[model samples]
Target: MSAVLRRSRKSPAKDGPAARRDIPPGMRPPPLEPMRNPGLSRARLLDMHRFLRLNRVLEDQLSALYRQGKIVGGLYSSLGQESISVGTACALEPGDLLAPMIRNIGSLLVRGVPPLSLFLQFLARHAAPTAGKDGTLHFDDPGRSIIGPISVLGTLIPVMTGAALAARMRGESRVALTYIGDGGTSTGDFHEGLNLAAVLGLPLVLVVENNGYAYSTPVDRQFAVDSLAERGPAYGIASESVDGTDVLAVYAATQRAAARGRGGGGPTLLECRAFRRRGHAEHDDMWYVPRDIVAAWEQRDPIDRFESFLVEQGHATKGDLRSVEENLAAELDETARQALGSPYPPPEETLRGVYAGGD
Candidate 1:
């Protein structure tokens, strides 16, 4: 994370004495326990670490560019919630579909989106997936089975549900995964989509990122239920809440959910409990969040926690992790330069793709 975006008052170690001091008693995370190996090979574990680091560092570079007035639109940072995206995405099979929200950029990377594509998209260069017409993650790669998110909240739930249904009809074993925020779960689309998926036993996994707030509204005000996972029972499907800060736990949960979907067990709802450490957008000042809460979550930073796990479990050394960071920094620097140098689409070219079969 960049210094410019680090608003937390203090950065405490994950298991240090000061870690939970500022956090509310009710909101405090449980004691840090040793994470069990999820049966991943040493190489795979290191790859997960690389993705986690890349997710954070890439956003840090974008945050810097946004501050310098280079990026075309608002940038959303998934700083503290990196684990959920990386963990869930890494569990997928080759042909599984992924529908990622604006904050789920890490998923795109895990699905093989080059960092250059993101930089170009954000920079609004002519080579971007949207051809410089749009400035956000409104582009998708069919080759990678990534469905770009629609701006309307909760809309992707139904879209991915349809995709899952289509795959089943075609006799393919592929599963579809999509995400929504805590506030988005209140949308009618969320209910309708999940209900349909349950009824038909479609291979769909819906991940609800319960990141404390939906924009500025806290989860408490958004729903009366004790936990979002409870809604799964109402729909007659399985549900579970996992520690979003723990990558291994999230990976395990997603693997089980994916397996259930593939085995004709219907959709599964996973509530990932994590906090959004930054504002909803780059322009918004996070005055709504209490400082102590942000401080507390910062100590549980997903990347930092994952790094510690890799070393403790003998999967990687400190030097190996440092090399990953250094290599990623260099790669991002080159990507930004290339994006900056790319030209924007010509005015006449804009009208060319606006309508089909009209030139």
Candidate 2:
């Protein structure tokens, strides 16, 4: 057997069977035990159900617009990977910082980016955040503690590390939550950011969404390491792996990591294992992905998985889940309609916000 295969079978501490075996009868095993220190209440679980469905509906609507050629650039959808963003975002406080990637629309929404704003950005209308200057997923609002991501992979790690440093300087008990792809862990900036964060003892939580592809390049071609979280220990940081599809597991791991960060502990590397059910963007046909691989991930679809967990655990009923979905559908429909109706940025206004004038 290959070394990579051997390493893949070795479970991390938090994801081991012992940590996950405490479920009651008829309940499926959790990827990780729910943390009591910051356990999720029934109300919070309902809220999570709402966020998960909200993200799915929004992404589906965007994809529909893309298919209709209304969207300007490539459209990325977080179809199978919604839970990681929603779960992690819910674990954070308002004062914390978040750096969202192309596939992190859920995280942005959870952090309070209105669906109207996202629709406007996608449509490149007059009131779009970048005034149509930016062609893709780039919308930053520092006042809301969210940093818009750049196109470059792995770069946000350093940006988040710096934000954590600044928070420390300001005496804010805040942590910076940043994300990267499995393929992103190969980039030099990933190492540099992590090393610096470790050395400076910066309060940062780095999430690596190991979705098994770097735009058609499989894990075998990306790196020799079996798991991306292995890089954490080398940098003297706390690290673990979680089932990204399991919303509760992701939330529990993130809650622990964020608490440690706020308590003067340095960074943590959380490798979330899941699969991206869509192409790198809407344009790609995903011909390279094997049929069986896609089929397997489909069985563990995050939203479906989480919904079942909620019902089986007696936290919610099927009707409750249905009501949440029904409510979000109306809200999303109204917001998207308004965004489309909004005016486009006038051609003459392109350079208005380019330079900062003396106030």
Candidate 3:
């Protein structure tokens, strides 16, 4: 009887499955909610700089791996979109969870997945945390709290929603945040996940990294909405839009939304506007991208913009920036070297981890 009572009390109707039906009529919630003054500071900005710089270092190392043929398969890169992942991860506490999309290699690093381990995972070494099942962004360290990439486009949103629901039921203060591509924003799972999160008042943040393309298809052909964040309000969730290239802006916006969720204010949708600098994957020539558009976005390089920001504000100098760049390069080189020695899972070991008890 005591156990039953405890379980019942834990999943309270006030904030769980049963309470959703009671949403009052005439609420007419706004379709978009902008985060006002994300509360910026020098310390915050410097961290953003480091994240963007680190992304550049890792991306370069990844390319070097490609050149050396260490990467068995090609890579999918988000050269210009580093801020979208790192900023959101920065706002999170140690226990907070982030479900990143394919482009969030930076998210893995920022969330405390060791750079060496990530490189090994990408290399499919036996030492990989997934034991070689996950390559790159597909799987995350459960210990680090990144739920999944699962790679099937928006499928993990529902999984994350389920996790958030369970966390809320257990009276846990944790929120589950899912990252998705602009292409994913149109999926059924995305809609269903947002609706459920809002209705339950579950702590969740759905971050849509809108980089203007769905593979080769442009955003105009992909969805009718001008802002992806607007979709959140259909289910009574708050929403915000941020400049994805501006690392500080992404950090600030995500920080606010995460704060609100942590305080039980429920889910928020953040639409981060940025551009992908390279092909969807390593071998994709990216010929479909308009050269002019790519050129314009290159001018808005987040790292360069942040470096200028730091220097203009007297926070750093050309020498300081150069030093940071050099140091990042050294670290990435070290990791890449470490990956060279890591062993691949032995062949015929493929059947391992395939079933619960080795079948």
- Against the true structure, whose lDDT is highest? 1
Global lDDT scores for all candidate models: 0.86, 0.82, 0.76
The global Cα lDDT (0 to 1) of model 3 is: 0.76
Alpha-carbon TM-score of each model against the true structure: 0.92, 0.88, 0.86
- What's the lDDT for residue 353 in model 1? 64
Local accuracy of candidate 3 as per-residue lDDT tens digits, 122-219: 79988887778778777766788878677688888778888988877788888788799988888899888788778888788888988877776667
Measured on C-alpha atoms, candidate 1 has an lDDT of 0.86
Task: Estimate, for each residue in 116-179, the C-alpha lDDT of model 2 and write its tens digit.
Answer: 8899899988788777778555989877899889999989999999989988898889999999
Model 1: per-residue Cα lDDT over 28-141, one tens digit each: 454566666689999898889899999999999999999999988789989889999999999999799999998888999999999899999999888999888776778889
Residue 228, model 1: Cα distance from true site in angstroms: 0.9
Compute the lDDT of residue 117 as modeled in candidate 1: 92
Number of the top TM-score candidate = 1
